[model samples]
Target: MTLRIRSLLEQVPDRLDQERFETWLETSALRIERILSRGHATPAGEWYDQPRDEWVALLQGAARLAIEGQPEELDLAPGDAVLLPAHCRHRVSWTDPDQVSIWLALHFASDGTPQPGP
Candidate 1:
């Protein structure tokens, strides 16, 4: 129980390492540092991927995530969160190129193991 509790605690970051994420084991669960990117869009258009429901937040800076084929834009900043449906197609409309972003991504697999991504 103590271990699981620790897993949910706010992470201590070493931004210099610049690593994408961390995987920590918990009782019947997993904790992971999520992957984030500072996006810069010169000329925006529709780009997309299959629906994979997930959570994303802006840990630093600001940007707009627009659902593909949709007209509304979601303005995001630090501490803001959105739970996108698995089939949602979203694109980054803008971003701050001058700063580093820290994001926490959490994925809970039914088998209680971390999902590794490239």
Candidate 2:
């Protein structure tokens, strides 16, 4: 089998009307993705409630994450990481508009129990 190698920071679009999601790997129990966002945010009042747990790291730029019932949004800079458990409501509140914000996200299988938020 041929081995393909690529950089995560390569091939970014010059202009983005919306956030771009690229799945790099997937298995029966896990998935890895590269997400690029610029001046993007979740719509007002919309939240994501996923069935699987997620570990997301900010590889470049900046962002803010808002979790349900949280008094304040979590600010993220490069090298920052957050683990979100299944059924935990969350949303992207902000992303840097001047530069592309790169995120490496890993979603994995989780038990039926939902985890509490901070």
Winner by TM-score: 2
The TM-score of predicted model 2 comes to 0.90
Query: Which window of ten consecutive residues has the lowest lDDT sum in model 2?
Result: 109-118
For every candidate, C-alpha RMSD to the true structure in Å: 8.0, 3.2
Q: In model 2, where do residues sit more than 4 Å from their true spots?
A: 111-118
Question: On residues 43-107, what C-alpha lDDT tens digit does candidate 2 reach at each position?
Answer: 99999999999999999999999999999999999999999988899999999999999999999
Each prediction's TM-score versus the true structure: 0.55, 0.90
Give per-residue CA lDDT, model 1, range 70-106, as digits (tens).
Answer: 7788888888887655456777677655554555555
Off by over 4 Å in 1: 1-33, 39-48, 108-118
RMSD of 1: 8.0
Clashes of each: 4, 0
Q: Give the TM-score of candidate 1.
A: 0.55
